[model samples]
Target: MFGRSKDSTAPADQAPALTEEPLGTVELPGGKGRPTPKRKTAEAANRRPLVPQDRKAAAKEARAAQRAERDRQYAAMQTGDEKYMPAKDKGPVRRYIRQYVDARWSLGELFLPVAIVMLLLNMLLTSVSPELAFLGLVVLYLFIIAMVVDVVIMWRRLRKKLAAKFGDAGQQRGLMMYAVTRVFQIRRARLPKPQVKHGDYPE
Candidate 1:
């Protein structure tokens, strides 16, 4: 009759309901009306130096960390492990483009050494044989021009293929330059080494 159920409602001597009302907010001592940082924010803030004292040591540690990271990235790149691939080499379209380029040989790869030799030969012959020097220079310049033309044609074709295969989004920023630059890098030495061999179809 006194609000008691058949099972005595709760217990013979029920504990009063413990309403958990927060005891207001505990403000930081010098908060100056600013809200306190959350636990996560405070933990993150506590980590890393607010004011660096040992700058030299900090720099050294940073360099060491960078070197370690570079080594790791290098290892990943060597095996063509896409997960750790550099930003430039991160996408499927880029990978396909690289393979397409790699499967074909580029004349530009030889330009660096050939240009150096031709210039040296001209320098040595300039006084002894002016005509010969001029001839050498002309041939060298012509070959350089040919290589440039070849690279241009290659990039144009590559872009078309890339667009056809991957649509508009395939033409990523700097990707054209990346393909163009890769034309000059020696085949074997290209980073994220070629997954395809010469004479193989990129498909």
Candidate 2:
């Protein structure tokens, strides 16, 4: 048989030689260089809803949160927690005033009860004699005058003490009125329940 040309193989079944690329030189299409997200993570992102679907339920929850907050503040006020006190009652000066006022007996504390008793007695006296009823009115007026004088005196003394302890800022606007109003309220009913016992005035 005649020898085949060198270019032609006896059998053309041999596979082409494989070539290896230099390390780190091969590039992948569409690669972003980030690790692939797990299936659970991808599914969670897709399932999350931006807004609540139940609007009414959301509104109710908001109101419940507000009410809870309000109740918490009320409890704090009753306990005299300075951090949660109302604007009117906050500050060290206010606390000092409260302690000072609570430590002493105030005629104003009895004014309400005395006035009620006088009114009832006067009503009964009016049925018995007009003159007695007139006398009752005069007594009530005198008692009122006395109560006013006592309050004025108390304020003057307290003002001096306040100035000594806290300077001019202690006698701040609305502070006097705040103290006066508290004086009128029965000690047992006062808010921010008295921290000091009678005669235990603040230094």
lDDT of candidates 1 onward, in order:
0.84, 0.85
TM values, all candidates: 0.73, 0.69
Clashing pairs in 2: none
Q: Write the per-residue lDDT of candidate 2 for residues 1-203, one digit (tens) a residue.
A: 99889767645667566899754555568765456678999998889677899989999999999898878777877898988767778888889888988998998888898899889989999989989989998999999898888888888988898889889888778888988888888898888788889899888
Q: Candidate 1 lDDT, tens digit per residue, 40-154?
A: 9999877987768998998999999999889878988899998887887888888887888888788888888898899999999999999999999999989989999999898
**Residue 132 error, candidate 1, Å:** 0.9
Q: For model 1, give the 10-residue run with minimal summed lDDT.
A: 21-30
Look at candidate 2 and tell me the lDDT of residue 103. Answer: 94
